[model samples]
Target: MSRFSPFSRSRAPQLLTEVLSRTDAFAPLRAGVEQMSAIRRDLDALLPDYLAASIEPGFIKDGKLALFAAHNALAARLRHLEPRLVADLQARGWALDGVRIRVRPQAVKDPVPPKQARMTPVGAAALQALSEHLEPSPLQAALAKMAARHTKR
Candidate 1:
């Protein structure tokens, strides 16, 4: 029998938390994840839906809780509510002395218009006139061809 069976290529048999908790190397990471999860839950419960949804829990360390805001405006708004948020988390046993907000805006992609093959009527007329004035040569022929190509359909 093949050691790598096709049937065994299914989804993971255990939960991610279960797998991560089992590894000694991931202990600190797991703890950090847990802390962040708690911070998010508490923030969601304490703040308005719009504010809570816009802010992401960055980390909590050395008696400080850090949060990520989508923009400076959001960060400023969060700052206004920071004291209340800190009190709420501290009341809930978070051991937080202060709250810090960081602006971490996500990259936005603007749609670009495709380049168009275009020429003004006046430009084409000028090129055509110049071509006619030139002697019969490769340059004149090339200019005539270019002017014709640029003419409106």
Candidate 2:
């Protein structure tokens, strides 16, 4: 392995917090992130589980609290709750003019398919019987092999 890999640098790795703290624009960026986190916490307390789970506080800027939802359905629901959410944030000491609900869909992983259904004994028997009527061919051979798996030993 090369000695120049990022993790193998001669100097100790600088923490992200340290690096950001040293940057000029980091204060506003960090404050925005923190405010959003607080908004999420407040939403968790104020909203129902179904809404809270699907919704996220995107950012607060220009007197607008932007909310992100996982899909259109949730976005519509959040839009309906806009006034109440704005009130809640105001109650939490956030100075905001409006709430904007946007559909910012999170990446969805494809669900692993369920295990294949096992071949039933009757179905296997049927396949075996059908295979017997056909001349030797790839289809007949495949059916016979499959049917044999379900045969009573």
Candidate 3:
């Protein structure tokens, strides 16, 4: 019979860090990712809430910062703000000459419409009967109104 041993679990972040640190080939890639993330944070801070939420930071190469907008409208808006954004980023210690905006629409699934509660004819009749038995109170009035509304559908 062969003996087997269970594998120990390791955290994904720790494992990824170890791999990136030990591999020289991944150093540049890791650096690029960290730089982009930092730039993204800074950009988000400088942008308006609506624009920041719709934009994503891309690569920075040759003194130009690339940005991805959710759609053409957003891209146009970003282009309008590009000069001011570049100056702000420069003030924040980023050596930016210009910004390039690109439209990259994200895949968003259409939300399923909520199922509306529908009252049956019998249920409406029951509510009407119950309302009639009760005195002229707010609850009775509401029930009658609901029954009348549902019965018309």
Candidate 4:
């Protein structure tokens, strides 16, 4: 039997556990993490007030944004605008490789998307007048025919 020493310090060796040193210890360190996911960004932003009265951001996966809308009408509206939304995201350097949208029914009133002007101007009559006066070169005839094809009945 060993005699007890009153003044002895800790005899345990220092542990070298792999779990403490691994990246799994901290969740925020994962790479390619989208802190602002697609649902959080677009559906939360661009959904119109008329339609936004019942929806919110949902899950985002593989560039797809899932949104919760009040009903089928709002879901239809958001689905209609998906492509344009993707374009806007690309312009802003958002990480949507190919953004997809999914609709889920929600249970709350939401604020509307702010009113914005249509950015592109409608073509004026002046362009048509210019085209009408141009001499009938092949290009001119072709344009005139093309315009005729597109002209309202």
Candidate 1 lDDT over residue span 1-153, tens digit each = 778889777685797679779979999888888878887888889999988888899877787788999889989999999898888888899898998789989678688879686888899999999999999999999989989988845
Please give the CA lDDT of all the candidate structures.
0.87, 0.85, 0.89, 0.58
lDDT string, candidate 2, 1-153, tens digits: 575878766877886567767977898876766677788889899898999998878777799888888999998888888888889879889899998778888899899999787888889999999999999999999999989977854
- Top candidate, metric lDDT: 3
TM-score of each: 0.63, 0.60, 0.66, 0.39
Arranged by lDDT, best first: 3, 1, 2, 4
RMSD in order of candidates: 13.7, 10.9, 5.8, 19.9
As for candidate 4, its clashing pairs are 48-113, 49-112, 49-113, 53-110
Q: Which of the numbered candidates is closest to the native, going by highest TM-score?
A: 3
Taking all chains together, the TM-score of candidate 2 against the true structure is 0.60
The superposed Cα distance between candidate 4 and the true structure at residue 128, in angstroms, equals 59
Across residues 1-153, which tens digit of lDDT does each residue of candidate 4 receive? Answer: 446675674566643333333666544432223443544555456656666556665445787755666677776777787788777766766666554445665557588989663222224244455668998787777665655544543
Separately for all candidates shown, the number of backbone clashes (residues 3 or more apart, or on different chains) is 0, 0, 0, 4
Deviation (Å) of 50 in candidate 4: 3.4
